[model samples]
Target: MTCALIYRGNDILLCRDENDKLSFPVVDINNYDNSEIIYFETDGTQYAVLPEKTAETIAGGVWRGLRESWGELEPKTWNIAAKGAELAHFMQTNRFCGTCGTALVKASDISRRCPACKREFFPSLSPAIIVLVTRGEEALLVHAKSFRRPFYALVAGFVETGETIEECVAREIYEETSLRVTDIRYFGSQSWPFPSQLMLGFTARYASGRLRWADGELSDGGFFTRESHPLLPSLPSISRRLIDAWLNGEIGGK
Candidate 1:
């Protein structure tokens, strides 16, 4: 028997047991005699993944988007599900070779290859930077226009071509909020996996400029003390970790 992460489109299948505990749906790939079960490994853990159409033949579980499944599944299971979703996205999107019109086949546990040109395709990872900018006792927080909830988050953006991650930190900060930052330093990293993103966290000191948000990107933003900050992102997010670190005297202090 093997544990599996089953996907229904972008949503993942999670089993809710009689005690109301949620877990990854148990799937024995051996039982699905006629189906193709894509397999992947993350952090040295092995898991199988299958699409909703194929998963329909199996019994049980409710479908949930990864965002909704957070904290519901244990931290380790949630991470495994995240990796499964990323791998699923890769499998779904890379069925055809970009260089040629031929279909692809599994090259290894982590890649696909075209039968015609022999080009290998691996899961794509987009790197993004999120920074907690400190101005003395206050940390910078903002509400992005795209947020589904009314919580504030740190300054963040994807790394552009030809820009270093540190440069991306400066560029995204300035582009989104018109603020200059100094003493930019690494904090940590997390697998965002909202369809494959690697979030790199950093801490910086506010260098200059009053907050003026770029149009169409941010709804509201400001610097605030720990006691003055509004609603923040959840514990599962790196944004919250960075903010928590600042408030707890772990980083971003003189």
Candidate 2:
């Protein structure tokens, strides 16, 4: 997050630890010249991470000072712990190859080389498209079938093969709700690393169609006016930023 440690300009590029609890595990780097890095064992139970959070935590400082303030620990921002965990997971899984059952190992540097098939593997990322469909002052929001009781967010979906991001946006909206969309506008992007997903956010104008819900995915769908809506669920996602921007206008609420 400090803008130096991360590479590739790939959304996050890099990680740092920001643990506050004394009960959290400590990383003993005495062997590595007593480096300040802290280590912790992760069982994939917490933080959606690997067997531990140590290597990632020590490097968490990479995100410090890059954020305008620490209070804004939003998903759009990447931290060192997350980056390290992602890398570890990426490497761990690349240990096996789908084409062949042979074992795999890291190449000279960043590339992963399979010993059996001579295939090279690199880190992977899932692309998600988040779009805001609006009509006049009203915008469309859908409640996920899983979180229908507690949360409701805007229309969003993952990218499918052979379609551009904008094309995917239109198709997803049509599939989820039998509606048409136009004036697709690029808003921003966010890193939704629940397990590593790169989300691309956009804003669109409603072209036509009545209220409809996608089968089995969304439980509810409707248009909402921020000023006159019912008591909606609390905002808990970087994906919600688009709706927020549209709701409060470009300036948004502080």
Candidate 3:
């Protein structure tokens, strides 16, 4: 499975790393020769420092000379260099060891190395569980307390230490909904680069217990049928796919 880097959404946003200071790591899909920086009356060459806005503009599906229809953008779908500015910030901030406060060096295997302590620090990504809980044909979703009213989403939480992925899923379900899951079927995963997270999406059958909201995470919880589906969060998201599988049958695309 290839993951996309640039988020054009049909509008493109170009990126540049002048002096390696900017964060957006956009590959020149056009593959223009960018050997040296030179200016001219007209663009001397097609090659140029990809401005951040170019990526965003193409992402929005608007072009200065040409145009495209309203369609989903087909991004490169792979970014070995990474995406989102915050990830760059994370790398920069965490370069120093918090324990000893020493400058770090980039390691060979995508991590920062400490010469003194011989410690290798990698880019940290949070593991979050998002489940599509079902009871019979109806699926469960929750309205998180902090969110605007009526915005329903799946039961999701960050995984903690000393917990298996399954354990985290079970714990999150019970803790948030006061409901237990009898079976959890692995559905799929997605890379959410808003910060950094590997989302593990699952489908769980509701075993027992009634609706109960724990703490401030979920303000409301309930079941919804396929026809009257709640205004759930966006699809193209792991959480949405899991529910979509349950509603439309896991095997067939709907």
lDDT of 1 by residue, 80-144 (tens): 88888888889888999999979999898778999999999999899999999999888998999
User: Which should have the higher lDDT, number 1 or number 2?
Assistant: 1
lDDT by residue (163-241, candidate 2, tens digit) is 8999999988988888899999888876554456788988888899887775567778788777865444454445557
Question: Candidate 3, after superposition: displacement of residue 239 in Å?
Answer: 1.3
Candidate 1, clashing residue pairs?
none
Error of 3 at 79 (Å): 5.3
Top candidate on TM-score is 1
User: Model 3 over residues 187-235: C-alpha lDDT tens digits?
Assistant: 8887665457788888788889988887568877698877787787653
- As for lDDT, the candidate ahead, 1 or 3, is 1
Best by lDDT: 1
> Candidate 1 regions off by >4 Å?
17-20, 33-35, 42-45
| Candidate 1: C-alpha RMSD after superposition | 2.0
Q: Which window of 10 residues has the lowest lDDT sum in candidate 3? A: 64-73
Each candidate's number of clashing pairs is: 0, 16, 21
Candidate 1 lDDT score relative to the true structure: 0.84
Q: Please give each candidate's TM-score.
A: 0.92, 0.70, 0.68
Every candidate's CA RMSD: 2.0, 8.7, 9.4
lDDT for position 100 in model 3 = 76
Predicted structure 3, TM vs. truth: 0.68
- Relative to the unseen true structure, what is the C-alpha lDDT of residue 181 in candidate 1, on a scale of 0 to 100? 92
